[model samples]
Structures are given as C-alpha cells and as structure tokens.
Target chain A: MALQDKYAELLQTATTLGVGNLASTEQAGVLHVSGTANSTADYDALWALYAKIDPNMASGDLMMNIDIKADAGAQLKVTTDSSNLNIRSTPSTEGEIVGKAAHDEIVTLVEKTDDSWWKIKTADGEEGYAFAQYLSPL
Target chain B: MKLTKLLMVVVVSATMLFVSCKPKDADIKAAVEKALSADPSMSGTTVEVKDGVVTMGGECKDDACKAGCEKIAAGVKGVKSVVNNCTVAPPPPPPPASLSTTIDATKMQQVKDGLKDIAGVTVEFVGDKAVLKGEVTQANRMKIMQMLAAAKVLSDVSGLTDKK
Candidate 1:
C-alpha cells in the first residue's frame, strides 16, 4: 500500500490517458503495473513520469510493463538509435539475422510474437522477427 | 326491489372471495427473491412478478446459476411460471504473473542482446538477477529497463550510473 501511495500520480495519469487493461499489484515490496497504452506517446509519458517520481529510478520498487497497443497489419516505426534494426529468423537474437529494417522506416506488423519480439514485414518484402523495444506502433 | 338488492350483495361477496383466494403478484415476487437469496451466487439476479408470472433479470455467474434461479422462482407460491432472462457473466481473466523468476539460457541471451547496442554498459547474471554496471544516458536507461521488463528479467541497475 505504501508503494501505491508513492506512485499514486502515475496510476492517476495512466487512467487519465485511457490505458487499456490497466492493473496494479503490490508484492514483495515492489509495485507491478501492466497495461497497454493507446499510443507510443502515452507510453513515453508514463515512463517519463516514472523517472521523475523516482530519480534515476534508483529505488527499484516499481515494475511498469506497459506496452503500445498494435494489432496485426498495423504500421510500426523502426526506432533503432541510428543503425538498421535486425530482423531475425526467430524471436531471440541467437536466431539468424534474416533481414533488416532501416531506422525510422515504417513496417507492417505480422504479429506480436512475444513481449520482446514482433514479426514484421518491411516495404521491400523482407519479413522476420525484430526486437519490440525498437518498434513503436503507429 | 328487495330481491334485486340481495342479488347485488351476493355478487360483491363472491368477487371478494375470489380475489382473497389467490396470492398477490407482489407477495410472489418477495417469496421468489427470498428463495434466490439463499444462494450467494444468485445475488446479482433480480426478480419481477406480473400476474403471478416471475421474470428473472440481471447477471448470473454461469448457466447453472441461471437455471437454478429460474427453478427457485418457479417453486415460489403463486408463481405461475418463470422467464429466465438472466445473462451469464463471462469468466474472469487469469491474473498476469507479477514477475518471471526463472533465468533460463534464452532469458540470459535476451538480456545480452538488449545490451549489445548500448555502449559502456555490461551485464552479469547473479542468480536470477541481471546486474548491470556501466554509464548510460537517460533515454538509454529507460530503454534498458523497458527491455529487461519485456524479457521478464529481474535486474539490479543500482550499479548503473548516469552518463553526464
């Protein structure tokens, strides 16, 4: 409950932003929150608020698992920090690098394979799984 | 004229007797509700009675509860029949696990892959915890945390310092 009090503003902001399936639970001294943000901007706003509330996020008392809402055939933007994002044969990086989607490129989502990986197809017809961390739903 | 007055009195008494013999719709509704209240699962059900016919409304936890409510209402005194209009509620979704405690090889590789692009940061898996030590910008720091969370990997970023 104390963790709930500490992050009340974050929870309020999430509700205000209309995050879908929002849920929160406190366990083992850490507050775990999971939901799907309506858009990438909303997701970024929540993370920004989290950082502000916990400076440098040093306390480690919260685990926010919010992700952007995207469905099959939805447009996704490649957000790699300059280099082309790797499209692998499988969800893990251990899989072969089958293709690549350039930074800031738009691709179509085939499916959300898992929390960390998504199967995507680029304009050039290259299709494979990529890290979801670098793909923002548009 | 006296015979005509006696005939009017007989007709009035007969009507009174017929009305008193049957229970009122309101009384039947109360009885049905009382019976339904015996089961906690039927708490959401609502009862309405018109002409001794009971109509069950609202949500029931499942089909069994809906049928049970209808049977209970039909058994009530003076209820001619029951119209079970109660809807069955969908089962609640399973709660999401708060954290993934296992640190399998795949999870460890995922942590390594997430850190590959970010320079100056190195990670070591100590027990189930991913201990990260290095300097990272504010944006990268957030990215690191999000990546770890997506992989469901518990981490120790206390050793990570802000890159000025």
Candidate 2:
C-alpha cells in the first residue's frame, strides 16, 4: 500500500484536530506530515494515533513536523528584577508604552516577534510588546 | 600438591555454602504463583523464578495490574527481587456516541444566538467533539469556551489568530 493510503487515518485525525498550517506531501516514498497543533494534548493525540497504527513506528515511511502551539495563558512570567518591563505597542524599544508588566508578574505571550521583543498581555487587560529578555516562558 | 588440594577443598566448601544460603527456585516460584493467583488482576499473568529473581511476563490491563504482579513476586519468600516484564495494555476508551456529519441547523442557530460576538467562528461536530475554528481575541476565546460549555458539548478550540 502507498504511504498516504497506509496513514490515511493519521492525516484524518490531524484535520479533525483543526491543526493549522497543515501540509502533507510524499517525498522519496515517505509521507511528510506537518502541522501546528493547537495544544499539547492535540499533538499527543496525533502521535498516539500514529503509534496505534504502527506500534513500532519503524516503517520509516513517515516524517512528522507537528508542533504544539504555545499559547499558555498567564503561565509565562516577567523575570526582570526591581524595574517594571514596558509593554510597548510595537516590537521595538522605541515603541510607545501601552502598559507596564511589573517585575515577576505573570503575563500571556501573544507572540515572540524576534530575538529581542515579544508581544504580551497582562491580567489587567494590558496588551503590547515587551523586551523578550525580561519575559520568561514557563 | 598439598596447596592445590587445600584450594580445591576451599572452593568446594564456598560453593556448598552459597547454594545452601540461597532459597530453592522451586519454593520461590510456588510462593510467587500463589500470591499472583490470589490477586484477581494478576492471576492471568505468568510467573517465573530463577535463582531468587522472579520474572513476570504476560498481558496486564494497566500499569497498576503490572505493578501488582511485581509486588506479589517481590513479597514472595526467598525471592530476591522482581523483573516485571509484563506488557501493560491500557483499557480501551469508551466508544464515542454516533454524531451526525452535518451540524444540526437548530443547534447551530442556538449556539450562534447565545454567543453573538463570536464573529467568523465555524462550529462543527467531529466525533462527538465540537471543533471551533476561527480568528478571535483571547477574551473572545474564553467567552466561546463558556458558550460551548453551556451547550454541553466537548470542544477543541483552534485559534486562527497569531497569538495562539
């Protein structure tokens, strides 16, 4: 049987999980499955299904690049000492300050724009960019 | 020749002492089997004892069943320890109730009416779990979960927004 036909159920489960940026293609006789799972539970469920289909996963006929989406609410914390981290409107130090994330305050990560800046939201409804160095992902 | 004779006597005496100190494999095996048979969860598993080490090999309902077998073998007299190689098969999850491929129009309308602010959200039933997919802010996501929860439907919310 073809790789696609063999792992059809796995692909179907990924779709059912509502995975984002899903791309599946066959290359060199290996079915390449890639997607961003909305949560870790969703990612694990897909792997469990794959394991169920092939107990050993020794077919060497599948390549998976599924990743768990990191949107942990209030789990990420601001780790800067003493000084409050400025949550800016843009992902830059020069951007206007929309809010302040106090030292050690837990914030929700909106996204990491680059190596130096991250978009974050505080529990008090403050949302903007903060220096990535000050925010620790938990 | 005398030294060689002395060495042979010492070697034979050590072997005899070692053998005598260890419990017989048959006794340990019998005790392990008895304990296993007494437990309903581990009664079906096979037990083996060799030189005081007990080995269990068979299918078990879960990790607890596998551990129970190991515990039984460990508690057996003369058994040094247990090497539980029992394969644990997790219990099969309950079957999902049959769900319609198409979303019920009335139910969909009721959901939409309940959460008027959920713009562009697509709700569909995937094997008894409602999958909500669309672009929404963090606050909107929480509201959507509450609305879906009120409808008594298990849900998987996939955010189209970049934040999630």
Q: Which lDDT tens digits does candidate 1 get at residues A23-123?
A: 88887777888888999999989999999998887777888878789999999999998999999998887789999999999999999997778999999
Clashing pairs in 1: none
TM-score of chain B of 1: 0.79
TM-score of chain B of 2: 0.48
State each model's CA lDDT, in order: 0.88, 0.67
Docking model 2 quality class: incorrect
Question: Per-residue lDDT of A1-138 in model 2, one digit per residue for the tens?
Answer: 888788899989988898876767775565666666787578657876765786434343555556456664636677664678888898655588899988889899877564346688899999998765455555
- Report the TM-score of chain B alone for all candidates: 0.79, 0.48
TM-score of each: 0.87, 0.31
Distance (Å) between predicted and true CA of B130, model 1?
A: 1.5
Give the Cα error of residue B122 in candidate 1, in Å: 1.3
Counting clashing residue pairs in each candidate, in order, gives 0, 0
